[model samples]
Target: MWGTTFNRSRSEQTTVPCHECGAQLKIQRSCHEVFMRCESCDRIYDIADYVAEMDDAMERFMEGVYCDRV
Candidate 1:
């Protein structure tokens, strides 16, 4: 029952792989919003501009960053 709600079918989930290293992202919470980080390359990213959808489990959030180090 929990699986059906939290873990949707793999194909249906919107997973965002790391753009640089192709690593899975972990969710980190901020006072205003949430963000993603890649452990392998230490690349940080912002999945969405707003945090309104952060609580939804079914929606897979992609990681993104605001500044580019270059």
Candidate 2:
């Protein structure tokens, strides 16, 4: 029987700025990941915050809540 496992080791790596030190970090995961640890600053960044904010804004828009644009 052939079985496959969910392996993150083969995920693509990306370089992103560290929220703490502003250094580049190699993120070994997908773009939809909620959080990642910065290799340079050793700090955890909440990437999902932006996604959550967008979701909230979408919900508000669906409810007919509009914000004034400058």
Candidate 3:
């Protein structure tokens, strides 16, 4: 009932706010790229831009990324 894990990516509903719309952003991925998306305004952002906002959710998601790598 929470975040769904896929083969190529992972995501979590995050407390991080979007830079443009000020809405909560979701940490998402496509293939190997990890980024954040704002559902309210349809905006995409590079994950590095929100490094200061990292928390448990982000930490867990990133760990999965590393596990999938060779």
Best by lDDT: 3
Q: 3, model 1: CA deviation in Å?
A: 20
For candidate 3, report its TM-score: 0.74
> Mind giving the per-residue lDDT tens digits that candidate 3 earns over 1-70?
2335623346788888899989998888766578888999998888889978987777666766744331
Worst 10 residues of 2 by lDDT: 61-70
Ten residues in sequence with the least summed lDDT for candidate 3: 1-10
Query: Model 1 reaches what TM-score against the true structure?
Result: 0.44
Tens-digit lDDT string for candidate 2 (1-70): 2223322241223344555687754423333333445666677655443233333322322232112210
Superposed by TM-score, candidate 3 places the C-alpha of residue 67 at a distance from the truth, in angstroms, of: 8.4
lDDT of each: 0.45, 0.39, 0.76
Q: How would you order the candidates by TM-score, starting with the best? A: 3, 1, 2
TM-score of each: 0.44, 0.38, 0.74
Candidate 2 regions exceeding 4 Å error are 1-7, 10-12, 28-34, 49-70
Off by over 4 Å in 3: 1-9, 67-70
Write the candidate numbers in order of decreasing lDDT.
3, 1, 2
lDDT of 3 at 57: 76
Tell me the number of clashing residue pairs for each predicted model: 4, 0, 0
